[model samples]
Target: MGVSSGGPGTGLLDRRVERGAVDRVLDRARAGNSAVLVVHGEPGIGKTVVLDYAVRRASASDLRVVRASGVESELELAYAALHQLCVPFIGPRLEQLPRPQRAALAVAFGLREGPAPDRFLVGLAVLSLLAAAAEDQPLACVVDDAQWLDRASVQCLVFAARRLLAEPIALIFAVRGPGGDPRGVRQLRALPDP
Candidate 1:
C-alpha cells in the first residue's frame, strides 16, 4: 500500500493498533536514549500518521517536538529540515547565516527570509547547531517525505543517528515506496542496531 494509508490520521493511529511499539519508543526516549522508527511504503500508506501519533503522544509526555517536511522538487535545498527544528529557538544570535545561504534555507523551509539571516550550515554543522540549540530539552526530529530528502540531508542524519545515545535526540523518517530511495532504506536499516 502507498503511504497515504500511512499518512497522518490513518487507521494505524488507533493507538490500539500500535500502541505497544509507540510506548516502547516513548519509554526509550524517556530513559534518555534516542529512538528511530523508519516507516517505508508507497505514497498514501499512512507513515506520516503513525509518526504523527507518536510525536503527539511524546509531546503530551513533555518531550519536545520538531517537525520538518521535504519537498518533492527541492531535495538539494540545504537546511530545510534543520530550520524547522530551529524555529522554536529563534533570537538575535540565531540569524547568523550568510544572506545567500539564508535565502536558500528560507526557500527550503518554504518561507521568505527576514532582515537578519540565519546561516544554514551544511553536513555536520546542521547537527552541531541543532544539538547546541537543544542542549536544554529532550528533542525529537521528525522529517516527513524522506524519499525527497537530499543526499546531504541524509548524510547529516546518518551522522546524527550514529551518536543518538549520547545526545537527547530521535530522528524519525517516513518514506514512500517505489518512490522511496532504496539506498536510504538500507542506510536506515543498518544504523548500528540501535
Candidate 2:
C-alpha cells in the first residue's frame, strides 16, 4: 500500500507488483478467461486500496463488479458474505441455474424452507451463477476482510475459485488478521505472485 493521491487508487505509490498482478487478472477476464487473486496482509497495509484499484480498472473496462466485506459481528452467520456477493444476481440469474443449484442457493440464502443443502451443491451453484452473470459482460468479485468471513462462505468461495474455467470472471479476496485461518492463508500464499 502506498500513499493515495485519492482517485481510484491510482495515486498509490510503490505497488507495481501488486498492480501488475491485478492488471493481468483483469486482462484475462477481458479475454474470456477466469482468474483469482487473494490479497493478504496485516491490517492497514492498503489491501483495500488495491481492491479499489481493481474495481476502478475493471469498471473502466466495462466489467460488472460485485463487492463484499466480511463483518466481524456476522462471522457466526453462514453464507453471510457469499449472500452479499451474490445479491446482484439472485433475481433473474437464479432462474438460469439448474434446478438443483437453484434450490441449493435458495435454501442457503434462507429464501425457502428445506433441510440443509449439500455443501458441494451450494459451491457449484455459486460458480454457475457467476458464470452465467458474465455472459453479457465480464464479472469481477471483490471480497475484503475475508479473514472474518463465515467458514461456510469461505469454503464455498474457495471451491468456486478453484473450479473456475473459461468464465470471464475474476475472484479477488483480501484477508487480514493473525486470527485468520492459517491453512487457507498459507495455501493462498503459495499461489504464484504475479
Candidate 3:
C-alpha cells in the first residue's frame, strides 16, 4: 500500500528491485531506524525516476521529505548542494547543534565569516542537523544527480550517511553513469551494502 507498509511501488518499468529497495529503506526509517541507499546507473536509465519514486513514496507515507539535485555549475562552490538539502532544517534545528558544529555549518553556509571550517566538524554539524529534524518525524532526503554535487557537500553527506544509527532518517541518493562524484559515490559504495 505504501512505504510504511512495505508495499510494491507502481508505474516503474522493469524496476521492481530498485523500488523495493527504496521502500525497504523508507520502512526502516519509519520504524525509527537509520537507512541509506544509493542508486546509480548510466545516463537516461531512469535513475532520477527511481529517486522520484522514493520521494513520492516518502511523501505518501508522511515522512518529512527534503530534496536537492546536484547542478553542474555549482560543482566548484563549497557546500552548494548541502545548503539546498539543509535549508528546511537549518533554522531552529540548527540551534540544537553543539557550538562547534553550529559554527562550522554557519561558516560553511556563509552565514558567518570565519576561517574555513574543518570538514570533520562540518560533517558532524550536518549529522546533528538531520538527526534533530528527525526528532519531530522521520526524515527522508532525496538527493538526485549526486555526481554533480560539490566535493565539500559530497564529503559532508558521506560522513552523515555513515554515522546514521538508531535514528529515523533515510538518506537516498541517485547518481548517473558508472560512478558519480568520486568521493561521494566511492565512499557511499563502500558502505556495507544495505
Candidate 4:
C-alpha cells in the first residue's frame, strides 16, 4: 500500500482516466511544484477512483503518499485534515492540548483529545516538515471527500498547499462539485500556476 500499484499505468481504471490532467499534474510535480488537483464532477462521477489511480501511479514512481478524508460529522474542527494526516502515528506524546479546544474538537469528531494544539499541530507540521526534509522524493497528500472539509481544515489545507509550492510536495483534493463549495473552487483557481 505504500509503493507502486505494480500495474501497467496508474491502474485498471486509469486507462479510461483523463491522462492529460493527470500527466500535467505529474509533470509539474516532477518539476518540484506542488499541485492542488481538484477532481470536481457530479456525485458518483468516479473522482475518487481517478485520484486513487493517480496516487498509485505516483507511489510507483517513489513518491511518499499521505491520505485523508473529510467527514460531514466533523466539519468545524480546525484540523480535520491534519488528523487524517496524523492518524497513522497516533499515540504517546500527542496528548497535551488545552482542554476547551481539545474537548471541542474531540466532541465534534468523537475522539478523545490527546493534548491541546500539540497533537493537532503534530500531523500538520510533520507533513510540511517531511516535504522540507525530503529533497529527492515527492510528497503526495491525497485528500478525499474534500467537499466535506470543515472551514478551518479547508483553510489550513489552502495554506499548506501554498507552503508546499516551495517544496517537493503535491496535493490532490478529490472534490465533488455542483453542490460543493464555490469558494473552494475559486481558491484553488487562484493558486499560482506552477
- Candidate number achieving the greatest lDDT relative to the actual structure: 3
Give the per-residue lDDT of model 2 (tens digit) for 1-194: 34543345366655666777788888888899988878777677777877888898899999999999999999999999999999999998888789999999999999998998887999999999898889989999999888889989988988888788899998878878433443322223312222
Worst 10 residues of 1 by lDDT: 185-194
Select the stronger candidate by lDDT from 1 and 2: 2
RMSD of each: 7.5, 4.2, 5.5, 7.8
lDDT minimum window of 10 residues, candidate 2: 184-193
Across residues 76-178, which tens digit of lDDT does each residue of candidate 1 receive? Answer: 6665555665577544323655445445445545577454233333333455545655567777777788777766566656665655565666666777764
Clashes of 4: 7
Error of 1 at 99 (Å): 18
Better of 3 and 4 by lDDT: 3
User: Which is the winner by lDDT between candidate 2 and candidate 3?
Assistant: 3
lDDT of 4: 0.59
Error of 4 at 94 (Å): 9.9
Q: Model 3: residues >4 Å from true position, as ranges?
A: 1-11, 180-194
Please write out the lDDT profile of model 3 over residues 106-128, one tens digit for every residue: 99999999999999999999998
Clashing pairs in 3: none
Any runs in candidate 1 off by more than 4 Å, and if so which? 1-18, 90-121, 178-194
Clashes of each: 25, 0, 0, 7
